[model samples]
Target: MAAQLPIPIYSSLEDAFGGLRTASGQSVRWANLAQEFKSRFGREPAYIARAPGRVNLIGDHIDYVLFGVLPAAVEHDILIACGPSMSPVSSNSGSVAAHNLDPRYVPQTFAPMLKSAPLPTASEERDAENTVHAESWHMDIDTKELRWESYVKAGYYGVLNHFFPAAAGSTTTGPHPVPVDLLVTGCVPAGSGLSSSAAMVVASTLAFLAVNNKVVGLTKGELVEMAMENEKRVGVNSGGMDQAASVICTPDTALYITFFPSLSAQPTPLPTSRTVPRAVFVCANSLVVSDKVVGAKTRYNLRVVETLVGARVLAHHIGVVLAPTERPTLREVLGRWLGFYEAKNVPSDLDTDMLREGVQKILPYVEKLRPTRDDGELGVTMEEMIEWSGMPEAEFRQVYLSWVDVEATHFQLYKRTKHVFEEALRVLRFRDVCFSSEAAILPRDTLIDLGALMNESHQSSIELCENSCPEVDELVRLAREAGAFGSRVTGAGWGGCTVSLVAEDMVDEFIRSMKSTYPPYKYLGDDELREVIFATKPSSGAFVLKL
Candidate 1:
């Protein structure tokens, strides 16, 4: 019942992928895909979902705790060609067959398993209302290891549970949504910071929703949440930033996505000079992949724990009790403090500026309280955190550590929290520069200034967040030397891709120079290098296309 297909349907043979102002050759591309789907599925496809990969323009590592992030959807994307299965192939069940055009990923076909597939526990389903109904059959995908198809299964299960809750038994009477067949192909580089996994998940969810006609009434925010929860099944504790960007973004613009009170998005216009009118973002791969999934224990999820623990310790030290619902985002803590200061200090005639400044000054950066025992292991002990909090061990563990096991002792509390706040501020400033009136007077300088912020962001990620690796920093240096105005690692750092604010006119030379100068590129063949190291325009958000 979606007002329109998530993707455009091509009624005219002429329009295939043409209606959405799809990339230059994308129209032809979709037309060909439709024919290919027909050949593979033995029927014409019912729908196609397009979810573009994203590059974090400024903000990084701050989104999951509900922070504002600026990101743009790139041209590279995961395209899901979907059609109903022609046969159930069994008396009791149906199946979803998937193909990877790239062949790098093993093809996957999934079905509803009544007992063998592990469904979510009632508590894990997000809410009481979302509990698995006796009639609801939410087939669980085994994400035990590095299975390529885990992403596909995650998306399928994500939408399945959301729209067509499987009634526990196959005998239960309900609307029988045909099992779907999906053929996925994409230009997005996998394992790079471009968010290819998110694109795949979003694209698959759209396909399932579209196939069931469940898309009509659902809002974008609802879909965003569903996709995020789906990803958590794969063990990565993601914030909605990537999924939000894929869902809410528009073509040729960056989205300033804020997630404080509610998920809201505003398009921030990029200033491009007449000659260089379109913002040119060059994504240079560091060739390092930070697997947020299994590595969740040591990297991304570990940082989430650190921030939570830090917030608890900070709150206890300052005598501010945390409300059960409040997460330990520094921004939220400061807001609460501001409210308290106003209530108490106004009567004392305290200078408002001094009171506000005093609040920041009073907040301490206690490294001893950090959960990380070693930055290398990215683990922290309960005893260390409890000692720092000056609170009961049980209270600290229940409030902050929760169910996670902190196995390492070294932590970088000062650095990680410092990066989140500073980077959050930088994202705002970077967005302001794009909108500032003076941007016209010094457009080039303005872009350069933006790059400087990126440089600072990378430096902080390395020095403080400890997310950057040797290759990540080296890539930034090389991109800078290659005439990038500014560049920094995009995604979860460690290894992935770098986003360089490149001058439009200089992009060709910039990419070429980077290839020649970087040692990694020395090994990639010309065609491979061309594809991986290229300039990108801010592309459209996730959508559907029909043939």
Candidate 2:
């Protein structure tokens, strides 16, 4: 593993965009945002924070299982123009007036309702189990109804609770954050798989950090960790892939992000063949809005519990020992089963071969999770699942169901497990192809193989993970029919967007084909169609700009 460095802060547009060539376009966007900021708030802005949304090129739901995922940061991003509020300084906390260029999201002006809870004594918090707990700073975030500014608040909450602690027993009180006025704008389509939420959270986090002068030495990985925790405040039990891709990605390469042994990322260059034109990814929105928070209990979060519980049951059958209270992910279960857990650095430490083969070897064991019923039931009941885990119902509920809320009468343990293992293997293979220099001669062949993996991934998502919707499935089918190399649903998947691997030369034609055929695109005019779908390249990650 390599040591990750701090995110760079740039002073000029040329440096921010990485070169003068790309700076022209970005300069216009930033200038427009600044102009909007000046009109919205009555002064020149002090700093701008930017975080790009990501398109998961290969991996999907396996990320929550601690598996590595291949995702690239797209050009579409969230930008926050912020400066100190004119309000009088307060010793306790800061206030914010947040406005969005998109009118649908109304402006919000609010402040953190700070409260100091009594800190527990050392012995009072200690237990024989070493389960230590501490009182944390409080901020209310309504996770039920979806709100745009909640993301802004979520970012602020982490900075406040982590950097400015004020427990009752504290000797030194933390300094108050400066009041801020922010104007937000983004091109990343929200509710689509492109990870607009993560972009928003990451940018908001950077904005808060910059305004407070705390971004001086923060590593990109550290920012990713904070954004991951921050997003949970909005009620989604998501994995770290989105935040990692948003914070750690580099231009022209996809990131292979792993959370297992540790959070680490490696940028894998996208392959290109001398025999064929370059390939690009086209993002086509399903326009169905996959709201992770709104559908979490029954959809996204439900799958998470199913996968975790499935791992527990599978581990029990595979003779892997787990603590009675332990809730291991499928990746951890695979490590234990392959005896890689005992290795000095583990399977993922070396190369993808060991991990790929391990997934193939353990895949047959996933059948152990199949329900032992005669009526042809594919899923197991809650009671049956508990029995399979060898844990009491209360304990099972406490370990897996206590923290997150999920609702499902019958859990598809077998399907979820199968999808995870298969998808994990695909991600490893995808990374291998991208890293293979031999691909130079057969770049077209490489694209085909990659596309096949994406196609297979979408099928698994449909049959096993059950995350795709009709609009997404239709878009994928249309993409394939329109000559895309491969296509699949890209995000949390109940509905959002489908990313397709298309030849660079055929992109315009492909978009034309989609518009002529796909129902959603039929009514959209040129501008509306552009907003809903477009070709994208791997772009730079999150950064802060100082004036």
Candidate 3:
């Protein structure tokens, strides 16, 4: 049971990082950002918002389908320095002037267009007692091409609609947002699958919330929900894993986040055997950019539709009755197979043993989804899928394909379901090993056990989910040959980064081996290579710095 705590705010760097030792270096970096903000915008910042990127250790594509995932906050993060603007143009209209530390992203200035309609009068409201009146706010976001300020606008859109309603004639009583100037700086590499997009959204969201005086009583869970909804505005239907890990994770532990019953998280300590050498998770970027927005229609979004449709077909095969409008996830389908529905009889606390048993019990039944056609094809066409779904073409398209944009001629229901179930079991097994290890008496093969699970997960991503690419595959191969206990693609696998388990003493040696053996690092200089690959540990999550 995770505690529901409001987002943290600190007056000093020392308090923000929880110690003077940790804050010493950060103080200089943050000070430099503030100084740069002054240089760019000609004013001292009032507040700074920080949010971290995350690396998923296991459970990749299953998160959108509502399964437990293990991910920890990386030390690399995004920071935003913002204050109210005083320009006459900005003062009259709630305009935002945004700049980034990186030159590739040019400066952008935009404002939300408020509606022209006035609010209903008190008597009119009383006359229409059962009716509700609402006005929508509009912000222009280009979903086709990736824009840096689009994320900023997405975050601000949520704040505008939720807090400030646009009504003409000054009839609305709610508060209006102030025009803001923000300077953005970050070390989280973009397109590396470390979730720089989520970090940006979280940091930007927090910046608006803090500047608007809406930070009071905003729980971590609420922030996660807001950020999740905010991120979808930028054109990727991602799971809550990235946003939740960025907001809710604590120091020195990986979060075990479950999504079915309700959004809850547990800070599970990643322990090592006392007898064996200590191990750390190393992130090595493949240098292959995974643009989720550009690739969503064919890769990410297609997988989502396939898995979802697979769940409905599986339920039909299992003699389970599903409403025509219901879109059940693989996890919910498994629950139904186990005789549980809508979270009834679901344990609040995560029981690895029970989850393990449930996966085992359902593994055989999943075979029912195998293609029974004699044509020797491994997948089903759209017509065949609709027929198997036991729904008319109109209803099937409405239920599954209307809300999301996905392009697929063939759907691999069997392969996708098989991978999801097996990968879920692997997650439970991995969690069990982490819990089994103790400081006093540790298993000699602790790292080996954990590494093996990671290896299995990558294989599933490659064969079943089909998200891994040649660059990622070769990178994983080199990592294992270079002495990683277990190495796999960390984030969305089309072209991102890989997380490897390596002994503490051998981290330098492991990096050296990768640099020499991997062709991508051959021409790079020391700093460039360092940025592409490095060692990392679980770090603290998002926070606000009051200047």
Candidate 4:
């Protein structure tokens, strides 16, 4: 059963986060990938792995620091058809080859690195030289750099080391390591806000696991953790949001995933025909792909580093004695500070009012920010953040800003912290509207409230986070003007795609009007625009198919 099946099942999506929710099914046939796999590899694919792309309805950029994020798995996904090679066993075991049907991605044929033993688990720490584990197979040169193939290799290695160790052959009962022929086909656009990279990595991981007979018993949560750790080989400090959303999402419902206490995904019920007069979600690409891999130093990773540094500075301001190398997030710092204010007998669960009140208490500690020479637009500098900090520069540097180098001395401590906490609350509010008892009686009002939350999220991302670029702003503006209920940048901003709320009846007009007015959509033909800009429902989690 383990060899024949895909992943563990969930009875409901809520049980998934609390445990997960399930949905009405929607699936496409694997006729093309199946045919392509056979055509290229000379045999049928033993199994296929599919992972969907997600559209964030409200929450943005809060997942990394470990807060709640609400994202819906859209219909588009990455699919990989794979099977173990039937050829005679090689003297060396760690051989795997991958082919992308799109042709944009170059195929890689890898030979075993001739390891002394099996690969190490991703959870294990690397030595000072950052060498691969003693048992591992390959070494990715330069831990900071990212390559297209590295993502795939990370997935392959994750499953291989976890399930098939060096000693696996001598004593293990499961399938042994074999050369895998992988054929990838993706509907999700790369560098779009929809998370194409995570989907690809997940699809690859599942495929590798299945071919090696490692799929059946693995829980969704377990797979999610593996995917998140595997992608870290690419070097960005991304959170579990993308990986978890792709794996645990249910169609017609958005997953409200929380990483703090533990990994859990609560599938919030989306409006249905029965609950509402009409409801639809549309995703429009700015046509500017914000590839996190490229320019990570200046763009994404810088923000990540800034947040951690900001967290450390705030902890210092509050007199919280944290060890060096401790990177507490804004959420953690806020909770600690809230405890400080509560003094004796702090409430275990603080409501929004109480949290906002906590912010009020901490407000006096926050100084009017001083700008740095470069990147002052992000708001405050490291120097200004610790102007009130008595901690020495060397110690601060050792503790917080050591992970990634930044050209900007100034960081947006206030904005970054403010956005994460407020947006985390906004996500909760959006979920509230989705599940409110009044949703059935007052669908239009509920929808309007939800739209307003999305609008606020966009403004915050633009004004507070400063991650939204001109292209993204323009597209969001165009969508709203074209009659979207609300629109916001869906992925890690700077440029990518925007998700919009719309009425089901108004979907046709909304798409048409935006296409005519928007430059990117104006240039594309109707058929092209249809694929590029369309409404979608929440989709299912990653699963394997016996092809």
C-alpha lDDT score of every prediction, in listed order: 0.70, 0.85, 0.85, 0.73
Q: Look at candidate 3 and give me any clashing residue pairs.
A: none
In candidate 3, position 184 carries an lDDT of: 97
- Clashes per prediction? 22, 0, 0, 18
Instruction: Write one digit per residue (lDDT tens) for candidate 1, span 76-186.
Output: 888888877775462335467888777677777666555434665775444433122222455444443656566776776666555555443444554555677888888
**Model 3 Cα shift for residue 263 (angstroms):** 0.7
- Which lDDT value does model 2 have at 389? 82
- For candidate 4, lDDT tens digit of each residue in 1-547? 1112236433332432232222222232466778888988889888877899888888888888877788988888887888887655433454777788877778877644435445557664355343433244465433455556666777876887786665443533444577787888888988888998899889988888887778777888888888987776666667889998898887668887877545768878876443365778999888898877667767677777667766776777677777655667766677777663233343243554565566566655644323335644646645765553446778767766565545565567777766776787788778777777743445577777888999999999987777899998998898888877789998888888899988888899988898888887888888889778889988878887764
lDDT of 3 by residue, 27-143 (tens): 888999999999877889999999999999898888888889999999999999999987676864558999999999999997765655443467633333222122355566666
lDDT score of residue 377 within candidate 1: 45
| Superposed model 1: Cα runs more than 4 Å off | 1-24, 88-94, 114-140, 166-170, 273-279, 323-327, 340-381, 390-407, 438-442
Worst 10 residues of 4 by lDDT: 19-28
lDDT of model 1, residue 358: 39
